[model samples]
Target: MNIRLNLVATTSLVALLSVSAASAQTMEELIEGAKAEGMLTTIALPHDWCGYGDIIASFKAKYPFLTVNELNPDAGSADELEAIRANKDNKGPQAPDVIDIGLSFGPQSKAEGLVQPYKVSVWDEIPDAVKDADGYYYGAYYGVMSFAVNTDLVDNVPTEWEDLLKPEYAGQVALAGDPRASNQAILGVLSAGMARGAAAGTASGEAGLQFFKELNAAGNFVPVIAKAGTLAQGTTPIMVMWDYNALAARDTLAGNPPVEVTVPTKGTLAGVYVQAISAYAPHPNAAKLWMEHIFSDEGQNGYVKGYCHTARFNTMVAQGKVPQDLLDALPPAEPYEKAYFPTVEEQDANKNAVVSGWDSVVGANVQ
Candidate 1:
């Protein structure tokens, strides 16, 4: 969904839908169905990203009858889709029942028949622009791209995309994931390109590749994927990742190395992550219950606690469902005011350009 709706407009939509009603399944019936199924498998959800660790734990505590199976927490969006495809015929722990993926992947996965349609009880609260008309996939939460710096190692934290090219930042900057396969990195490239004056679609994707090529040639781009541990160890002193992830990392680091998250003045790209049930999910009922739990006020607030703006964030705020403490914890709302939210077509075009050209254009071969 596009951020052009603005919070006020979205709140208005939520108000309009408040009296319209919600999904059909009752919580008790879903719980009973889930308990009979007894298991829920998921993939590519890391404890440190978007406060998912606590969310998962809460789900387990709330539904003690079901076993939560997690797989490859570090896998990227592409890997998640691959897991669904690889396990289409399998019904074991490797088979994921639910998926939290990049926006473009929602439609792509739905098109490939990897995901099935299922709307949550709070469906009415979600913005129409972000959710599928047929309920195939819906946004969960979103965050803008930002720089996570190890303050102990960096005297000057870059606040603009161009600042990363400065000589002082040599061998210090790194992307959070491999651009070829990771949606975050692919979008990271688009953000940088937008800063360099390229338009949003394929042009930005190509421009981003050239930008990274320069960074690599100048010895300022680290080929290794950057994360909390890598940032603390100084392997990647400047990590480019989602603001939520960077903030979570800062909290996780707890001042050991002094972490700082900064949203760049230019190319402030906002990325939305959506959720969907797997078409081949062995425990379909449990998956539906999991969706209901996450889309609930508690679940939306759970994401907010991790610094993500949930799909129902505006609605929850209007309803006074979000805690004051969580509101205070978020990064300044001013930067996000100018954050760009690309449409699915733009994202698909940019993703294709970045993925197909990364090796040929940038040649980093990031591990």
Candidate 2:
């Protein structure tokens, strides 16, 4: 179960043995170290994003000794990397111990030496395709892109990407984050391109940029970064974001103003977020413990409660670990039938295109 022991990369046998010996420490020892550290700093994790509010409470309840220091909850994936880089020389609270970032940022982070390698106890259970072979980072959870509509403000609900461009939807549509930096927003554009029948990769990215350009020109695109509050207030009637985020927002709003979450049948794109420990973490043990906890059965279920599909979903279902009620609580599976998970390489290419082209192509600065 402890794949990290076998995957240690070292030039000398002594170093390998040293890491193996350290990895052999019991969970109790890890707990003790984490308790001694007494704090774990995390960045870009909003409480509602993946039931992290409850999950963080659960961790606090279980490990009373450690305090979870949360940084900017709304920071984008690029912002997360910048935090690591900006604080590499400082071992203060501003320095994040861990990060939850987009899949495309995983390899880039590792390549830039921003993150350290540490596999959870259930390493083998995680799908190999979404995890680093050396354990620098691994998929945490994922959700499909969807439109969260404020029914009170939008009588004609948009069921498809193109439907949002109609004049009736003017001043209504918005993206969840800044496309120039946000993984979610960038991928949303990719989804729109895919919906337009463009092939995935750079082509789709370019297509998505053009679509947004037209959307901006049509006066249908709101420059505001939409969230639950903005949607409920009718500030942004239609938000393009991950299904999990839309679901969470819908739950939080409790039908006040009412909400409709729809995964466009033509352009459903599944985006995965990954987790990693900062290479210069001030609390390495606590960060590792956090990783272990998130990959655990209870932690994974917490994400399910927030509408996200955890990385170990298949394994948990096969082992009958997830609760039946939680599974039943999810939205209808039909809309996600054609959800597409882009390759890391493809995402990297698409992200480059979107980020570079967004300002000039879209001309809408999403706050």
Candidate 3:
């Protein structure tokens, strides 16, 4: 992910101009506007174990008047982008009211003018690095990239990026598809690069490309898989996965071959799940309402049940909501604090180069 401070200033200016042109309304007024419109909010999100269902349930409970429809494409970011691109011409019901996409794709969506801006009141609680300046997108939750090791397969678990390249672990390690293929997998490579002293945010940097090339040459690369259960059950000794998936897998692998998840001692990349309103949403009022509700205290707390990290730092700390044990399980937050999210310009300039690099260095090995 790329982070550019200038984009935030640009977005803020646009939002200020937008508000100046329209009459400002309070939160209650916005809710009333939403109710009067009888609008429906459509969402596009992944069907993975990222806690989308939990968020949906909360939204339904709060605004019974507003209708919420979801379309689970179960496709990669590129596929989702294509769907959004196709809808631009049709302007059909398939057009989303809101989109919950991976962080890496947030810039592409913003750059294409497919996203609308609406900053919530609690926006200040979120770090600037994880959010868009114009309110086009806000990260709802995040997962740190980490290694899941099957204790039964190897006596010693790898604690750093360099450890994965050991001769003994050759052909034993597995990664998510190329970063270009999956946002999470891309962060996995970027995190390893960061540990090697690469410049932050830019994906085409030497550290990132070289690190991926080595992982590929080691025969550790794996394409996206529908079922990771077998791997968690020891079918594969080691795999790169997000914190939630790793935790879920470990919970599932309780009896048989126990699995352990570690945020590498060297460092790890954190991928955020960002939410944005559609540029041409049918229910703008309801879409804004949905954003307000999700960032509210009640909604953010629900993530704790699924072991997902909420984006609002102050709220989490104020509620005393985070469990002590889970806090212990978390890697130090400093790295995440300094984490990056790409800007529209950086993404536009480097996306092709980065994708092509991954294709040559990593995708070639996967095939």
Candidate 4:
């Protein structure tokens, strides 16, 4: 009977491993596999931006054994794609296990075969429009465009698009990027496109460029990308930037005067940044674990703490997966209810149009 029991135990162990090998169906299995893999690396995630700093901290606190390597905290989205291409076969820190990039980069990445498909446990909670049905990439979080106003320099905080063009705001309105090349700047224009035109917005219409043209003509449009220092120095006191950026400056610039973050009343465009596992990931198990952690309730909450609206927020609320304080921290949800998220195709097209048409519309070089 002892011999029989020993044989049965051996067979059971083999079966459990087989299931685990096929996929990490349970947290216990996922963790076990991740520990074996031992390391994970990421590209272009600035910890301070979008609550990544705290998210990384919490992730480390949870998985002490799993070494998390953050590479190039400031690399752009294009640079991230290049890294995946360069390290397709490497196993060292040079090989990225995961990537978070702009929405426009998704279709291009999938088509180029730079990433593979893997669905997190919270996959169903994510919106279908923002994620691949095959599970390659999913929306991580979205930030609505907002005004980061310097109250010291300006008496009236422009609440709407038309307010930005008023004489009082001349030389005060600044864009975050060059519309010809900057996605951030493009999103600012796109957000303004909505407020300048009808319900659908003018990404494809003539109004977007015209609005900027008028701002430029009025000397209200500052060509340079504005940063916190610029705001503090009063160079670009009123910057058109992401809501998260504006809100984050509150804590980051706590020593300076308060930075007010406001969502425009005439509707605004939202930009979604998606996360994906590298197809050439050297640490495959660790990569999946990282994805699981990011989509997990704890991970989503980390983003909330940073002032970004997580892609799974509504679902988290329904399931009671988020903390109350994090929920309370979010700016009012109604103004953003008017916020529109374009399809990947729509985003790509709009981006192309914005970049190509920027020269004709504004024509001013970023000084």
Candidate 5:
């Protein structure tokens, strides 16, 4: 009787082991399981941008079981970084699964070890120049830094960067705050530097400080608080901004004269809002799945609808997702083909220098 009982126990254990092995999930299966877990992914993004709202809505429609808690974080990227640093160990509601921050801040965040490395399967489609080698961050969407000329304010719009220095447009051109205070503004300075024929590493390198000194001297600078819609409404006639923001401005001022957005002939600086998973994410598996979803065809096409460029190389075009006519409206990717994205080390070293130079040279004169 004892031998029969031991054999039955052994048989039961074997059966249980077989069941467990059969139930093990592949990566795809694991993703499905995570979706069913009904977990929430908290995102920190700029509340003012309309594109963000559209992206959030699309994500919810696709994943009804997953909850996305969007936090405004009213503060800019710098403020978000400070908040994250403060809550490193005890991440309160502010602890985010993902963050969408300005291009300039991407490197700093990565170097500080604030980001986690998770390479999405679609990573191969992204250009090497736009993504970090270690997969700490990847640019999800980008905008070319272009000039938004309020045709109503100036009779002859300045088409090129050098044209801004002409005596006629003096005191009319406005930048987005200081370069140090606003990354968009810095890109503007960078664009101007390129137009001025400054080589890389010169004081004028990465948007010439020397050229800005001349602009400041010429009194061509205008000052206005940086917000999404106000600049297009003629708060400041000519301002520098991202292509999406410029297009939105054009749409806003449709009835009242048009705002012309020009990509400088010398090529404009492009800024990307990169995406990264937080190191301390509570739901690591969910975060990885979310990154995969964002890079998928459906997600890439979503950006096109919002008038923003998709990050996926050819997903949108191959799938016939975006209208061909819309392609014409986008600035050719080739002109910006030589665009610069500072490395983590270079950015960290120069961030303070860029900020300090702007403060001493241009900031004091803007107001």
Candidate 6:
């Protein structure tokens, strides 16, 4: 079933067969094939991360006959690739059928020949830059970098990027991870530097590095990687992370300690993650079905529910698929109006530069 189409409409689940790149095998045929396979393995998807808990549950409720096995929820994008390679010879459900990976990994996965092409029904709605030309991978959802604050621990709330460098936030500002290794932390630095007109490239993302160096020197920087629980426990009173994670943390500590997610007025980076099917999926039909579900109205809505922007967010908003409350809670959309997406090549080339510069320029200042 190699039929292909890129319908831009708000495609209904019932009409999926007509729009799917896998249309030659209709929705019914795919469902039947999936049932025969009887199971799907999805790797690196934490149940609570980005509302996967709800999404994975919805999939199970929708198809009770098929079993879905989730493995290594905390695994990284590279780990997902490793899982695919290690299990290529295995036909069991131990092998991942699908993956949700960082954007930088998408093109690399395609180059490695680890991902297969199967465009979702809402293909035309997604931006071309976020998806591979041959449909090997496509963006699922994206989150903007933001400040997560523990309201109970800190009296003053920072609503701007510059606020983190203040003496008030001394020893309070924490990164999501080491800038040299963490995608989230690197982005936090990038967002800060870019907002101040910093250029990001192979020359060590200097603007970002310089901004972070100043932050560290101010005694505001903490070397620890802060998680939601860390903020709740006051280990790191302020954290730089994705808005969805901040929102999720807020919801988690609803009553005891208020957690507030802030999108800096100066600007922030929107981090996009892509989804792809394994080239050697043990259950290819189930993998295709999974993709169909993700790009459908229901699936895209899941992204909104998780506080992340769906790839087809604009289309969904125009179609009124997103509710007003969720819309209201979203970080102000203006900063994202001019959001920049670094190309895969740029991400790779500049990574070493950033890491090298971090050690020399920023790391020493970090507490």
The reply for model 5, stretches above 4 Å from the true place, is 1-50, 65-67, 73-76, 102-104, 205-207, 282-286, 315-321, 328-352, 365-367
Clashing pairs in 1: none
Candidate 5 residue-wise lDDT, 45-103, digit = tens: 44334255566677777667777766543445665566567667854556677767766
Candidate 6 lDDT (Cα, 0 to 1): 0.76
- Please provide, for model 6 over 166-273, each residue's C-alpha lDDT reduced to its tens digit, 9 standing for 90 to 100: 788888888766676556666677777777765555543677788788988888887777877788788899999888888887887785688877887664566778
| Candidate 3 backbone collisions, by pair | 2-341, 2-342, 179-186
Q: Candidate 6 has which clashing residue pairs, if any? A: 47-53
lDDT of 4: 0.76
The deviation in Å at residue 204 for candidate 2 is 1.0
Look at candidate 4 and tell me the lDDT of residue 285: 76
Per-prediction TM-score: 0.94, 0.94, 0.78, 0.83, 0.77, 0.83
Clashing pairs in 4: 47-53
lDDT of each: 0.88, 0.88, 0.64, 0.76, 0.62, 0.76
Model 5 error, position 256 (Å): 3.3
Candidate 1: TM-score? 0.94
Q: Write the per-residue lDDT of candidate 3 for residues 1-367, one digit (tens) a residue.
A: 3221111424556666753432255777878878986655454453345555676788877888877766644445555566667676655567667777776688778888787778887878776766777677888877677777888886789888888877777656766544565555556666676778764456433466677678667765444342356565454677777777776667666745777777775655656678887777777778888788778876676554455677764457666865666556644565455545444344333445456677665555431
Residue 355, model 3: lDDT of 62
The lowest-lDDT stretch of 10 consecutive residues in candidate 4 is: 1-10
- Report the Cα lDDT for residue 10, model 6: 31
Off by over 4 Å in 6: 1-23, 92-94, 177-182, 213-219, 343-348, 355-367
